[model samples]
Target: MGKIVVSENVSLDGVGQDPTGEEGLRFGGWFGQVGDSDREEWAKVGFAEALGAEALLLGRRSHEWFAARWPSRTGEWADRLNGMPKYVVSSTLADPGWNNSTVLRDDVVSEVRKLKRRVNGKIVVYASGRLVRTLLAHDLVDELRLMIYPFVLGAGDRLFDGIGDRKPLRLVGSRTVGDSLALLTYQPIRDAGA
Candidate 1:
């Protein structure tokens, strides 16, 4: 089985929303406001993961957003994401224009579970906050890779807002990057009952 890892950039106070006051409390470009060093460092990690994955999983909103942005970025990372298989979870979006994209219109959890069984490599989920919450709730995420920045935006979309229950995770890795962001890697704790 493959892993579903959420790679997101969040503020110190846990806000992951828009900090520029454009989309109300939505964190549309929260990470972009960070310093270049911090941004690049995260990009390095996230892009590496994206390249290593067999496919990219995204929600409808994130699919539209990344489809517009990542395809324009000319780099090895961009090529990987643009060329790799992408599975999008949506009820509305009938078609997506990002190179190798597929819409998953069936039951979310069941579909993801089936995908997990078939993937031979990683499944990276990027910047899908609402989808992240749903995956967490359904035990769909095998791991969570969070790039925690140092600054806190008193208010914005948080990373863990609608999580249903407290899921146990084991920290597999942690590193501080250029005194700005902390890279935290965690895998869900397998329950004894399971």
Candidate 2:
């Protein structure tokens, strides 16, 4: 069975929105606040994750965002990301412009379940906050890999917003990436009685 891993870059205050300043939010571009060394280390971590993942699960906006940038880049990481199977959960998206992309127009939960069954390795999710919340609500996520940046965006959409219930997780790994970033890996405690 495929393990659904939600990998994200979040702020110290749990903000995950507009990290790249693409959305033009007030606190956007928090990702650029860090130094070059920090960013370099973060990129290495991302590359390693992409190398390990069997497939990518994304939302429509993220699909569009990545398709605009990654397709033109030529490198090992870019090649892997562009060639990997990508499933975008989008009802309105007619054509996923990215290579090896599929649009999931049906119920999100059921579609993800089917994907989990079909895929053999890790299905990594990136930059899809709404979809991530849905997966968390339904207990579909097997693990969370959060790269926590040092900045605290006092007002913005957070990573854990709108998650109605208490979803418990156990920290499986923790490390610092460069000088300011914290990489945390957590596994969801699925068994309520455990």
Candidate 3:
């Protein structure tokens, strides 16, 4: 079985919004706040994560965004992402428009549970703030990989907000990427008698 991995680029204050700077949020372009030296390192991390995934789990908006962009990109990372099976969690999206894409129109959590039973690798969820929160709230995420940026955008969308339940995560690993960004991996600490 595979684990549900919630991976995202977050700011110091846990904001996961507009990392690509194209989301049209007020704090769009926050990812560019990082220096140029980290670009290669960031790409390496993204590539490794994408290639390691069994498939992708994304929200409708993110699915559309990636569908519009990644196909035109030419690189190992792009190829991997373009080829991977993408399971989009949405009730309203009829056609995902991305190759090898499927829409989960039923219960998202239950469908993800089935996906976990079916796969033998990782189900990586990236940049879907709403989907991430839903997974976290339901205690469905097994791993949380955060690429922490250097600054705090106090007024943008946050990755860890509005999750009404408590989900304890234990730090599994930590490293510095390019002298500025911090890569943190955490695993959920399961409680007995669930």
Candidate 4:
């Protein structure tokens, strides 16, 4: 089965939104805020892993936000994400503006399960707090790759809000970048008979 991975750029204080108090609460490029050579390398590694993914799962809001920006980007990472098949969970979005994008109109868990069965590579999820909470609640996420920045935003969206259940995860990797960002990777431990 393909792994469902959540990769996000969050803050040290568990804040994932408006870290820089930028417009639209985007944090003014949170991922690239404190860029250095080491941080750049870390981003390259993360983006490369995302490029290897067979599919991308995004929330409706994220889909629309990215579709408007990434498709016009010229970098390799942007190209990869824009070109790969995307499964967007949405009720209002009947037609996504981006290419290689599909709407998930039914049950999120069931549809994601079906997609995993059919794919042969990684399924990457990025910046979808609601969707991330659903996957965590349902025990569907296989891995989490978090790039924790140094800044702390007092308010914004978070990935762990409203989670109902708890599942143990094992830390498989950890690295610190020059910009004080901790690159953490965790894998969910499977329970017996699960």
Question: Which ranges in model 2 have alpha carbons more than 4 Å from their true place?
Answer: none
**Using TM-score as the measure, which candidate wins?**
2
* lDDT of candidate 3 over 1-194, digit per residue (tens): 98899889999999988887886887778788788878779888889998889999999998999999999999889899999999999999988998999999899889989989988899999888999998998888999999999987888878888998778878999999987999999998897433
- The whole-model lDDT of each prediction reads 0.82, 0.95, 0.89, 0.82
Quote the positional error of residue 60 for candidate 3 in Å. 0.6
Candidate 1 clash pair list: 17-27, 18-26, 18-27
Off by over 4 Å in 1: 19-29, 192-194
The model with the greater TM-score, 1 or 3, is 3
Tell me which of candidates 3 and 4 scores higher on lDDT. Answer: 3
Tens-digit per-residue lDDT, 1-194, candidate 1: 87897887778888867644456654455656668877677778777787678998998988998898888889888888889999999988877989899999998889899989988778998877888899999988988988887776677668899797898888999998655889889989879454
Worst 10 residues of 2 by lDDT: 185-194
lDDT of candidate 4 over 115-147, digit per residue (tens): 889888899998888898899888889899888
TM-score of each candidate structure, all chains considered together: 0.90, 0.98, 0.95, 0.88
Give the least accurate 10-residue stretch of model 1, judged by summed lDDT.
19-28
Tens digits of per-residue lDDT, candidate 2, 35-72, equal 99999999999999999999999999988999999999
Off by over 4 Å in 3: 192-194
Q: How many clashes in each structure?
A: 3, 0, 0, 0
True-structure lDDT of candidate 1 = 0.82
